[model samples]
Target: MPPGITTLAADAPTLSAANTGFMLICSALVMLMTPALAFFYGGMVRVKSTLNMLMMSFISLGIVTILWVLYGFSLTFGTDAGSVIGWSQDFLGLSGIGVNELWDGTTIPVYVFAVFQLMFAVLTPALISGALADRVKFTSWALFITLWVTVVYFPVAHWVWGSGGWLAELGVIDFAGGTAVHINAGAAALGVIVVIGKRVGFKKDPMRPHSLPLVMLGAALLWFGWFGFNAGSWLGNDDGVGAVMFVNTQVATAAAMLAWLGYEKLRHGSFTTLGAASGAVAGLVAITPAGGAVSPLGAIAVGAVAGVVCAMAVGLKYKLGYDDSLDVVGVHLVGGVIGSLLVGFFATGGVQSDAKGLFYGGGLDQLGKQAVGVFAVLAYSLVVSAVLALLVDRTLGMRVDEDDEISGIDQVEHAETAYDFSGAGGGAAPRATASAPGTPAAPTNKKVDA
Candidate 1:
């Protein structure tokens, strides 16, 4: 127990129990986001499409877990080749790594790192399901995601985070995944929407969510899980940068929620639960990239701007004549761009990287880098996703038939219903409940007494 000897030993890096435990908890929290996403999108669709919507997000957990274990992780993080993609398949199916294998400089095992990233792989494609709500074929969507992650997401993940990645080489910063996850998925969603066409009823039909409470619940779950999503990207328990990320995640999200409410009240003369949930999500997406770099006040500005811009952007689908079913293009695409760009202006040298944004006297250096990353992912995703969607549509059929669509995708696609408006008995079952004003009545065999 010599003092100098102990000091020397302490200086040497060793296994960290605190960091390991932190990553594990963060991994689990991120895992919850998928199911939470299911609920979020599920509640926003028609009652007839509830199960189908849930299944879309739920299916990703199953599909991506197996895929990531098989080779998804390898292609994304393996030995980098030419800085565009990872080349080694040594870790496929969790094979090459050993029991004592640690992730580079960290005490966390490679397996822990693998599974933590797997949650991200699962969630990215699921984000697109919201845009295609109430229309796409379940089987087609299943296949499309499988192809998409392999072709689009994996490579893009490398470009942003992998060793020797071009973007990494250029000093581009994406602490979480504004480019890889939100912008990528958002662009891909718009691509698929273009190929698949609109929901059966576009401008004419009054389509609304079946359950606002459920939407609120899902948003709450997303906000809860987002702590892991944003903060866990740091992958350690350092109180300095990690703590700042945690605070910024919360601050930005709260500001965005309030900003959205204010915008709603001013424009529509009413604040809505849907606006609150959507704004919170917009905040979450915007902060995902900038949280690690910006101050708390900076985060507030990012979130508030995103909240207002996205709220207004959602209406673009209507004006532009594109059928974006759930405002994915609006919220995710616009919000992601806002966050990514703001990082160029708001980034501080002390937080994580030495890169300072324009406002911090770094000039437009980081801003230009951010723009390149943003549009690069957006363009690549948009083109590739469109091609993939068209291929799926041509070969296997992307949308359900008109008859099945009108009959409710739940019963038509899954042979199950979310809510049985037409109970069991044919003659006396409760159905339609007076049509709920603008909504069409639920079809039932029972005759109503006029």
Candidate 2:
């Protein structure tokens, strides 16, 4: 071969088919999480608002996908803009990227990276929906998602994960999305619920979950998908970092589940299914940021701490009376903080980067950096999300009418009910009699089982 041809071949980037396949699968797994969240949040709401709850999460998959393709990806992953946001004309509409272009230093195609990140963008806003369940108008909710992702999620994601992002430069150790996804969504949930006010009855109502089975299923799916969410964030498993992350994710989640059940058994005297499901999710959230940085043992600590902290935090809504309908603030916000901060203590100085946590002899320096990343995302998301919620509320009317809310958001918003009780209900069918059928079937006063 000619010298020029040989040099060209040497300089050209090599694509890893294995890594590409892995990331693509990971992207699909992350995408599955949005619908999984739909199920999780759906099962937590009253029967009257079940479909509405599901739709709130499912809508994000549609809205965020379009935005990400257009400019969301650019605003997030493009060239650095003053350490706050990203901007690159080549990334606008994702039009200028070549088919084989890799993401900075990664082996997978940039498109794969874009789609993978897009899934994260999709799921974050869906998380906030749990807090707003059973109250907001569907159209208003959809609009809020559009505005929230644009104003809040994109910028925060950039700050944490984008190239030259402030937190990334400050040495924050978010391997996945503890700060960007969970805390951001959790804080945003608090902001919106504070603005939107409580569900109709507030603390007076029972508000028990309509279906524990659905919640369990959703939690199970989240646990499965999180392997991709946490492990795949390493981009590839070639160096064993991703494999270690995968292992840490599992260890932490198991520890968290057991810890949460233990807390419930001690505090409430029973290991309820809801508690089990919630505990598992708390574990998943706690390990998301810490998994890549900590050992399996450290992950256990992170998971256990989050499980107990979140279990207790869920009750704060009652004490403070803000009405976070589904405990997004408790699990995501608290768990995210637990994972992010613990990295300052549990980090092994062997994975992701050389940064060591306090326990590893790195001292308070890394802890301080983690603190900045945590509070920065928290404060920004809280203030801005509240403002946006207020904007949407004033103009478009965030809540449904009082009567509509009392009746059911599913019927009012979606024009359908989650369960078709019509055929089996009180007035659905005439009572059948064992006596003479022709005798009007009237004398029998037995109630129908509808």
Q: For model 2, what is the C-alpha lDDT against the true structure?
A: 0.92
Model 2 lDDT tens row, 189-275: 999988999988999989999999999999999999998998899998789999999999999989899999999999999999999
What's the lDDT for all of these models? 0.91, 0.92
Give the TM-score of each candidate.
Answer: 0.91, 0.93
Number of backbone clashes in candidate 1:
0
Error of 1 at 164 (Å): 1.0
| TM-score, model 1 to reference | 0.91
Q: Tell me which residue pairs clash in candidate 2.
A: none
* Colliding pairs, model 1: none
